[model samples]
Target: MYKDFGPTKAVTDMTLELKRGVVTGLVGENGSGKSTISSMISGVYPPTKGTMTYKGQPYSPKSVLDARKQGIQYLTQEQGTIDGMTVAENMFLGEEESLGKKGIVNIKKINARSAEILKENGLENVIPTKMVDDYSFEERKMIETARALSHQPEILIIDETTTALSQKGRDRIYEIIAEQKAKGTAVLIISHDLDEVKHLCDEVVVMRDGIYINTLTGGDIEPHNIRQNMIGREIDGSYYRADYECSYDEEVVLEVRNLSVSGIFEDISFELHKGEILGIGGLSECGMHELLKTVYGALKPSSGSVILKKNGVQLKNTTVSVKNKIAYIPKDRDKESLFQATSIKDNIVTAALDKLKKGFIITPSSERKMADKEAANIEVKMRDIEQQVRDLSGGNKQKVVIAKWMANDSRLFIMDCPTRGIDVGVKEKIYKLMNRLKNEGIAILMVSEEMMELIGMADRIITMKDGKLSKEFERSAGLTESTIISAIV
Candidate 1:
């Protein structure tokens, strides 16, 4: 199939087939057209050229509902559940007639059904009657998975959905996929994590520059081989930091003293030093995410202070933090970090507006120069800076977020899952960038669910359990996932 957005060719002459009872994996670099192909197959977008055949018949869907009616369901990488709607409502949205008689909908019947689905999918704690907006990103993702599975789809497309999920949620998804495979359902999973693709997929297809690459099966489904085929090059084995020592300056940059956020976290005290990479790891509900946001001044603490040691100013809001040259890369890039409808240039230059302005007036050329320089510096794949950020892939959207902060020349970066949903190549770039930032004496407080990332990149690792610091490990060859997992679990 061929898909084009204006002059940009998202998917070019992509020919593919899914086999029943077989799990297919799609691996590609950012903007390499993995999601686009999945979207077309699920009827989210129409193909410009080429055609698809399903069950020995021509299949062309006009809309997502049309595709779902034909036993095809998709769960997108982005937030798929609607806010202000109950979990049950969101699950049975398009098919409410099944849960009602005549023209009236039976809310209780749907809620009970939704509850059963949630329990079966290992999300029994989620209240089906509660609004989806009240749940965390990870919970909402599992809820979306439940909704997709409720239909018993013949073809299921999981478009990078696991990137937002915690390990428990991911394991639940794996269980569901295994069950689906046993039922002879064809499953297509798109992921940047090569190991996940290797573990879950029976056959892996590679795509590059919107064109179809070779497909690997059996023993060929290795990380290095998949990485090379996706990026068209051989990446070094050492994709993370090489050092085994925890070294940083004696000067402290930010200090959190007795930080308490109501019931979220309490007595969270830590000192971030210059040139240090302080990594925080924990379960999705352990409150580390809220702690990072509180320190960044995005969340109001019940009692305690986050002070910038440079000037001894108490951090109270996002404006104050940004003005103090502190950057934040949130995990929920779409809703929390990016202005979806804005141009890439606008998004990048928004952070550097203070520097782009001369006195009180800012020129268009100055904005353009700053945006262009930072976007190119981060190597954001786009037709031009004028393109909307929502048009870019998940990894590219992350690049735009990093580029925006880079333009501001931030002194300290509070990154939450900085490499989440990004490809290995961009992850390598970010790891290298973090190293460079640390070498230049910039402090980094990174919160990641990926223990390997913390072990591989951090100078010091802190694990959180039940809203409290459980363990702190200094960087050494002895640091491993077992040590960290012991603290978290």
Candidate 2:
């Protein structure tokens, strides 16, 4: 466990051994120090105290490159790739010098080499000639896997990197892990998806906030137990929002008509009441994302219009969507959300700049006050408002992002995958906040991959398949995981 963020420390007086040909999962919350453990093992950072012995030999890596030389490869939580460069260029980034022959950078040789590497790694579909920017985050990660495989490492370290992947991409990574296990190479994986940890790992190591809690092997470990250990408490009900009834029975606050986006969805329509929590469920590619984007005006609906009535006035574009008291929180808090380089104050204030200014002159005092207030409301764990957002973990960063838009006093909100990578502790707070907003008569439109969330939080769950509404379930009675799964698939 990390004692401090900067002078990070691995767990003290702790020892655990991973067997060869076995997969071991490290599970914890966002700042529970699991990633710190992985980083120390992978040589991203060495422990302040305590020595790591592998194969009965004292081992310490001065840098990531040093760790790679010792046959240990790390795939970071973030997908590391150059945007403008070709896939081949990124694959051989630092190792290009080794691939070079007689001080010559052979473009042809490298391209062919990248192609061969991808083919060997079961990713021949990703062309070496294609620009890295052209590939999705999952595709790029696969390319990175191929690159790591080319290094012929012994033990592979998969940091919490799989959440960015699609199902197919995740399957490919699983296959890679299996291949390495067959070779008797030890596997260490870190993940927030508890199901993934259970299925992939032979043994599970659970960590609480900055502490090594417990370790359990196959048959001995249970999912509920693991979750409890991670949170350090017993939880009631679902991870999603608590049950509540709609308070308003008046006219629809938002209406969509024939909303269609090319390559996304077809003519679809829906209405949201002024105070209701609506859940949209679909398979990974069932246009749920497009639906949320359309409502938030993030994507221009090809032929349809989202007519939002606020105090009997209609508004269109996202600029007006906000003006009409609508707010949307995206799923990818790291990517399409938080401003990492700026302070917490900046990220929170940037969203509502107009509120902090007197005509054209901005007030720093007002901005700081607003930022502090929002942070406090969201319970954002940070040292101070001046603290850079980059230092915070996934859960805290997401809280800051939520604070930004919620500060706008929106009447209607659309949240897309808001709880993707966070842990249950932060998740509970988010659920409580949603309930508070719902009680305040704010309409909520949410799309979540987790069925348990839909089953618990939504007043009504709408299932979509192939761009059409497949089914709808009311919260009045008889809603379960099995029921939602049946409707979704």
Candidate 3:
């Protein structure tokens, strides 16, 4: 199959088969045509060349519904559930007629079915009648998973979905995939985590630069070999920091005192030192995300304050946070971080408005210069800075989010799941960038669900449980995930 996105070739000469009752994994770097192939197979776009055969018959779907009718279901990388709609509405979005009689829809029937599907998928906590906006992001992702599984598809394609989920959510997805495989359904997964591929895939396919590389089975599906095939180079066993010391300056750059948000998190207090990478980790419902938001001034705390040492005033809002040189990279990248409808240049310039202003005027040439310099520094792949941010892949979009803050010369960063939904190569770049920030006396407060990420990047790890602090671990060569897991669970 061949697919072209305007002037760029997304997929070229790619040919593969999804065998019945087998789970196949697709591993590739961002923009390596992994999503493109899945999109083509799931009928989001038609291939420019080559044919697809399903059940030994010519299969060409003109739309997603056509593919769905043919028993193909795809769970997208981005948020699939729509806001302002009930869970039942999103689950039966295109098939509402099936729940209706004589042009009138049966609301109770739709809710009942949606509830049953959620229960079957171990998401009984979610209320089907509630609007999708009422649920947290992780819950919404699980709802999307349940919607895909409710179809009883002949072929299932999940694209980078697990990275956005918590460990519990990911385990549920693994169980669902196993169930589909047992039911003789062909399954395809596109993921950047090699460990997940090794866990779930029966056979793994590698792609690079829109071309098929090789397939691995059994022992050949290990990380080192997969990394080599994906990037055409050898990566060291330890891609994280070389040092194993808990080192940071004595100065407290930011301080949170008795922070509380009703029903979310309560009485959270911590000090982030200059040149420190303070990691917060816990289950998805632990309120660590809300803690980060409160500290960044995105959410007002019920009773307590976030203070910067440079200016002794408390941060009351996002404007004050930015003015105090604080940058926040949200977990929901597409929705919270980037301006999806705008160009990369514009997004970058938005962060550095004050810096680029000249006597109450900001010029386009200055914007272009700052945007170009930061985008290139981060190695964002694009035709140019003028390209829309939505056009870039997950990894590049994250780079832009970081680049904008870099353009602003922010002294403190509050990142929630900084490397979520990103490829390993890009993750390495971000890790390196974090280290650079630390060396320059900048502080980072990172919140992540991935235990390994906190273990690898943070100088000190703080664990949260049930809306409160559970434990704190200092960085050491002996620090392990088991130690942290005990605190989280």
lDDT tens digits, residues 1-489, model 2? 233555433355445567889898888777677777777888877676677887889998898878887899888767688888999998877667776788777778789999999999888798898899998666788888888888777788998778766667788889889989999989998887888888888998887656777898877567777888888888775656544453454768888888898888888888888678888988767889878987888888778778866554434567877776688888667677788899999998876877667889988899899999999988887778998897777888889888988777777889887777777788878888887887788889999887777777778889988887888888854678787777767
List the pairs of residues colliding in candidate 2.
1-11
TM-score, per-candidate, Cα-based: 0.96, 0.91, 0.97
Candidate number that wins on lDDT, 1 or 3: 1
Ranking by lDDT: 1, 3, 2
Residue-level lDDT tens digits of model 3 in 1-489? 999877878889998899999999998888898998898899988999999999999999988888998899998878888998999999999888788998788999999999999898888888988889998777888888888888789999999988888787788889889989999999999998899998899999999989999999999999888999999999977778888899999999988999999999999999999999999999988999889999988898899999898779788899988887889999998999889999999998897799888899999899999999999999998878888998888999999999989998999999999998888899999999999999999999999988889989999999999999999999999999899999989
Candidate 1, run of 10 with poorest lDDT: 164-173
> Could you give candidate 1's per-residue lDDT for residues 1-489 as a string of tens digits?
899999999999788889999999998998999999998899988899998998999999999889998999898888999998999999998888888999799988999999999898778899999999999888888888888887789999988888888888788888888999999999999998788999999999999989999999999999999999998988877789998999999999999999999989889999999999999999988999999999999999999999999899999999999999999999999999999999999999898788887799999998889899999999999989999999999889999999999999999999999999889888999999999999999999999999999999999999999999998999999888988999999
Name model 1 segments beyond 4 Å from true: 100-109, 119-124
Residue range with the least summed lDDT across 10 consecutive positions in model 2: 1-10
lDDT, each prediction: 0.92, 0.80, 0.91
By descending TM-score, how would the candidates be arranged?
3, 1, 2
Task: Tell me the lDDT of candidate 3.
Answer: 0.91
Top candidate when judged by lDDT against the true structure: 1
